[model samples]
Target: MLLHMFFPSKCVTCGSFGKVLCVSCKNSIKPVTQDSCIVCYRNSINGQTHEICKKTSFIDNALAIIKYTGAGRDWIGVIKYKRAYSTISEVVSIFPQSWIQKFKKITQYYTNALIVPIPLHKQREKARGFNQSKKIAKEFSKITNIPTSCVLLRVINTPQQAKQPTKNTRKENIKGAFILKQGQVVKNKTIILIDDLYTSGCTAQEAAKILKIAGAKTVLLFTLAHGKV
Candidate 1:
């Protein structure tokens, strides 16, 4: 077929072009869940949201698609750390149709919601030549017909959350790192936070807190992969 002639249909992970991600690799990745705080979506493994998250009043809900390990980590690392843009489409193509169905179902709960991606510091963004979160948001928007806003501003750069050794350190590292752009109108509207990975979730929680403070009705989080917190 003409489709097979030009594209070669390789796997995203191992370059097996006939299919995107091979079945073996696909089976290797799995989803995980923890008792998450209703406010911050931090793994409430011990119990509910603590005083800190309650103080910030962060996101209302959060969900992640795959556990951030094994094949999941490899996919994220290859795309994010290695800057493999073309891999996104192939990787994206492999998502179960269930995700799209779920996305459509839950998103209907918030009509006319604006999708926002966590922002990157200008210097890092410039150096990387792209914001992976924004790229993912844009791609999701394209499929869902949702509008995306890159209004969340990272006024100052912080150490990457992945490198932070502890949850407490991650919470501190991203504190005061993000601010809603002035004149942005999110008041009374719902927002969906899109990102590539969710580890400690401090970054999304902090960003959502800022949005809520600015009068957003709700901020929900979604990521392609997650790790136990």
Candidate 2:
């Protein structure tokens, strides 16, 4: 990579040269074998919202792949903070094969579906140069055979979720941040919202609520990592 040439990388794990994460370190990041309720993080059927929890939930499921650790976290850190675009590919490459297959089966819920990347505020997106969620969704579409969309726009441009002062503040901050683009065709469709990370699930929830209100049959979420610091 051009960045690697400028400031060569060492493997985050084995300290090998020329890559932020070498092959061995990449192999060490384990897949999430068990799916759980995103709200409670306990075993559940396909990581869907449990009956008790769904009463107050917006998303049908929120499935995150690898744990936010090792090279996984390193990749996210580079992508989020360092603006290292090359690492985005590395992170997406590590999505487990098993999870991809599982996702295929789940999409059977809708004959018509869409992979909606969580959109960014226009100003922030212009500054960042790209929406990482959109990049992830594009690659995710390859395996899941789902078309990706930027229909969910963050019209509000609130403070960054990570910079929010508190969890409650986060919930409120993202409350009206998203609005479905006009004339989008999500009615009666299964919508899978994709993001780079799942922090408190507020952003996903808020986005899902708008989709549900817009008449999506089901709203599911998938993220590269759980922002479990």
TM-score for each model? 0.80, 0.88
lDDT of 2 by residue, 45-124 (tens): 78889989888788988787877777677767666654556666675666767677787778766678899999989998
- Give the winner by TM-score: 2
lDDT of 1 by residue, 1-229 (tens): 8755434466556776455556777666765545466455557632235567766557766666677787778778766764555656555656688766666666777875999998999999998878888888877776567799987999988988888999899999999998988888889988989999877778988898888888888788777776656
Alpha-carbon runs more than 4 Å astray in model 1: 1-27, 31-57
Q: Supply candidate 2's per-residue lDDT for 2.
A: 88
Q: Which parts of model 2 are misplaced by more than 4 Å?
A: 1-16, 94-96
Q: Evaluate model 1: give its lDDT.
A: 0.75
How many pairs of residues collide in model 2?
A: 0
Candidate 1 deviates by what RMSD? 5.4
